[model samples]
Target chain A: MSEAFSGPVAGHVPVLRLGDVLMVTLQGDLHDSTAQQLQQDLAETITHSGATGVIIDISGVEIVDSFLGRVLAEIAAQASLLAARTVVVGMRPAVAITLVELGLTLPGLRTALSTEVAMDLLTQGAPRVGVRRESP
Target chain B: MPEHTAEETHGSPTHEVRDFLRRRREQIAQRWADEPLFRSVFTVSRDEAVEAGKAVVDALAEVADAGRVDDPDAAGFSGVREQLARMGVARGRAGLTAAQVSSELATLRQPVENLLLSDIGEAPAEHVRACATTLTVLMGTLRVVVMQTALSEGEALIDRQRLQLLEVATPVIKLWDGIVAVPLIGTLDSARSQVVMETLLQSIVEQQARFAILDITGVPTVDTLVAQHLMKTVAAARLMGAECIVSGIRPAIAQTIVHLGLDLGTVITRAGLADALKYALHQLGADIVGPTANGTGHR
Candidate 1:
């Protein structure tokens, strides 16, 4: 079971694996259905593997609307609940604007320039967990 | 000039008949002073009163030539005198003295210089009142028409402006697998942000998608208020069971986040869409790799 969790399957979505860090690469568009499947698979992986962190790669996606952006944030929250850190990598410039406009920021999810950078950050040490101040 | 008695009236030429109709119209217009509705809205100004007085004197000349009155000479003279009196009153209201009013009226009655000057006195206020009522009606109608036109054009302009703003602010795209993407490209002012939020929420519920990604890579900067709105979207997504990922953070934006002292410590941050995707897959355990790696680069 652990070996099967090492990398993405041939027919399934592509995910990158580097030692303790797992990276999933999303290609094409991410709407509600795709986001749901991604969330379910990620949650199971965190629960089963006891892996410390997960990284999502979105370099191939051209456009991202509000719905897809929300999914990414949800994954982070879910991963945190399962005692795993979530990181997203390679977001496009246009995608960034849409997310900000939609106000879709993940509270604690670590974002990186690339999968390699994300993996590097995860493996180096305990991820710096910044505490959010409660809004009065 | 084979003018005859009453029997000849029936054989009048077309031109004569037309002339008769024109004279009848003039009479009706002259009698308009007695009509209440017409009088209510029209108030004749001093200039209009003087012009009308001149026109009445001119018409009397024509009527006198046709011998329509029993005593044409006396009637014509009396008509001129009456007009002069009316002119006097109009001039008085315009701040003219009795002598000035008389001089002005005399100049207007130049064509009828032979008219009797008897009974020529300052015109009664009622004459001015009648002229004023007629003028008021004309001005009021004109004002109503102008206002209606302006209001209609203003509404059209507002609608056009609204459409232009929406076109500039929103970008919609449909991808494969029943997924639709609506990219918001601009600074999310509070108002614009609300529109984006409402649109996405409606689309997700309507489309019933399993995954939704909100990539804000085009965003130049994110302040605390923007960050808070993002948090709200994430919460909203959860309620629908649709996954939401935030992607794209320029170094500048990240710096702003830190500088603004926003503790997005609990919020998921993605450098770009790729990273968000990788993390998303890992969560689903769709990672073919053994459970050794959690699929997210963050440890």
Candidate 2:
């Protein structure tokens, strides 16, 4: 889980491909620039790998400011465009409070309690009644 | 020469004043009892009134004996202030108004003056003047103490009211077996939100509720801050493993949210409490299944 990414750039978000699902585990504080770069990298990975589902584990990120919140939403929106379902997993309690306080409700964003649950949600195929999903 | 030696042999000027007051204690107290205003104004029992009057005279004597007659808050006058404050609180609780107490205190001086004049008839002119001045100053200190007690009583009342308001503002109610709703009213500041969050979370665990509804209909408006407070509450509930449903979005509030472009994320929101409850019930896997004798049941 603590493995580093050997990509061209240092501190680049590690995007691991798991079978048909692409898993990106976010750790520590995410600066605005870091979020922006992650957004671009996630979109590119989803397109090149042809992944049908993208799971983002954010249990490690301590604070989700408005900018980072927007980036997460953009990632989810972009992944869906590339025919992939995006599920954010493991949002901490304090992070959730800060996110709401920032007034970034992450509207239309899909979330799960853990990476396991996120995987379950992805494997279930299609979202429930009110949950947002990629249009068929 | 005899008078000067008598004064020098005595403890101090305060000693002379205290000696004079002690000698006339019974007389001053009797005069206080005889005053028409004393009986009319004081709400305590006749015996208690007499006792309180005697205590005041004794306290004044102690203040004069300490020799710092000009300073009411002096350490020497502490006992005097304590006696007067006790009298104030006792009379206040007995339904006596501060005005009545003030007027009664004024009448007390008349008796002391009469006693002072009669006692001064034998003393030298200079000694008489010094004693009168000390007694007058001590009386003023008593009055200050009484006023302070009145202020403290009013402050206590306001503090209790604030607590009552907090209790009334956030009420956590069990809407169903596994659902709790916290109806928030009034302003939602950081303080009130903290209380709301604590009460809701505690209720969730106690009721083992799977769903919580935060009905904000009583909340008059939805600004960015208010919306943020609501969002924080929902997030906290989610952490507790209970689904949160926000209800009571008026037309004006909906407009405000859209105008601000605030994203509530995927937190479920409904138009009214009933709708939120309906959604909560569905999430709990409970169907109405037609109203039954035992209320409703889970399918």
Q: Give one digit per residue, the lDDT tens place, for model 1 in A16-67.
A: 5566666798888554555677788878777777788898888788787776
Q: Find the number of clashing residue pairs for candidate 2.
A: 2
DockQ of candidate 1 compared with the true complex: 0.02
For model 1, the superposed segments whose C-alpha errors exceed 4 Å read: A1-136, B1-126, B133-141, B144-152, B171-181, B281-299
lDDT agreement of model 1 with the native: 0.53
Question: What is the CAPRI rating of model 1's predicted complex?
Answer: incorrect
The candidate that achieves the highest DockQ relative to the unseen native structure: 2
DockQ of 2: 0.09
What is the clash count for each candidate, in the order shown? Answer: 115, 2
TM-score of chain B of 2: 0.80
RMSD (Å) per prediction: 21.0, 8.1
Please tell me which predicted candidate would have the highest TM-score against the true structure.
Answer: 2
Query: Which lDDT tens digits does candidate 2 get at residues B96-132?
Result: 7888777767767767877876866676667767767
